[model samples]
Target chain A: GENVGLHLPTLSVQEGDNSIINCAYSNSASDYFIWYKQESGKGPQFIIDIRSNMDKRQGQRVTVLLNKTVKHLSLQIAATQPGDSAVYFCAEKSGAQKLVFGQGTRLTINP
Target chain B: EAGVTQFPSHSVIEKGQTVTLRCDPISGHDNLYWYRRVMGKEIKFLLHFVKESKQDESGMPNNRFLAERTGGTYSTLKVQPAELEDSGVYFCASSRSGQLGQPQHFGDGTRLSIL
Candidate 1:
């Protein structure tokens, strides 16, 4: 079965430094990708998304880079903060409304 | 505006007991989706509803689980005679429509524990 997977299960970064998370997808037909953040005892919150037509998209302090050729996607967060500590998940749209999610990466900020 | 809201943040039941989860999507959003995450696994899609009609239910594990969205407003998922493997977190989400590339907003999810 085609799936999306993360490079690492956990990541720790120093406060004020940048952080990057990587994901690889097996399905080439996927056209849309999204990043979500989930805090403890909460739902997955929308972070940012990128369309397959574009290689990169930027948000306030986050950026999503998509490599269609390699079927890889990465999320970069600038200036990591304490509030950034959470589980980050990358998901790809498989069909019309179905999203295939990767195993989440737990990001911890070392203050 | 209020985001997606789910009832009973947590549930604990016996293996043979039944459980029902509810989700109230954002007002006017006609697209509803159900997903679940079991222990140590990624979130998996269960089904999707467009308005009051089921658009796709390929992900549904078995007939023991049933979902309904009456009047296309709120939806409920019922799992009868639950099993130990049924314990997990169930999440409901909604988007503006069936349009491609629309982001789906999620709810906090209901954590179900079957003993």
Candidate 2:
């Protein structure tokens, strides 16, 4: 079965440090990848996205790197802040419609 | 502009009871979707609606769940005779188009607890 998964369930980073969350997908046919951040008691919020044709994309203080050959995706947050603490999810667009989300990685920031 | 809104932020009911979740998407957005996240599980897609028509419902868990979007505005998902396994956060989202990679704006989910 096709699935998206994360390398770690939880990650802790000190404030001002960079954080990296990794995800792996089994479906190679996926054409789009997205990163969503879900704060406690909130729905997933779009962070950044990348198309299959691109290997990397950068947003405000975040970046998404995709490796189609290894079927892996990663979200990088520069200068982690306490507000950046949340569960980050990596999702892949299946076909042209549905999105398959990874199990999510809980990111904690130490003040 | 206001973002997506969901009613009754939380609900607690006994097993075999019924619960209905409501979602109001962003104004002028024609595409709506339903997704849920069970305890310790990934957020799973429930269905998608293009106006009043159901575009894709392949992710709906079972017949116990019914979703409808009348007049192409607000949508509701009703779970009849809910079971313990149905306890989760139901999230609603919307986008302007049904395009492949359009960003979907999401609302705070409805937390349903089946006792």
Q: What is the DockQ of each candidate?
A: 0.50, 0.46
Name the 10 consecutive residues with the lowest summed lDDT in model 2 chain A.
A1-10
In order, what fnat does every candidate score?
A: 0.67, 0.58
RMSD of 2: 3.7
The stretch of ten residues in a row with the least summed lDDT in candidate 1 chain B is: B96-105
Q: Once superposed on the true structure, which residue ranges of model 1 sit more than 4 Å away at CA?
A: A1-8
Every model: Cα RMSD to truth: 3.5, 3.7
For model 1, the docking class works out as: medium
lDDT of 1 by residue, B13-94 (tens): 9998999999999999999999998876789999999999999999999988999999999999999989999988999999
User: Each candidate's TM vs. the true structure?
Assistant: 0.96, 0.94
What does candidate 2's lDDT look like per residue over A1-111, in tens digits? 111233438999999999999999879999988899988788889999898989999999999999999999999999999999888889888675678888888899999
Q: What is the TM-score of chain B alone in each candidate?
A: 0.98, 0.98
Off by over 4 Å in 2: A1-8
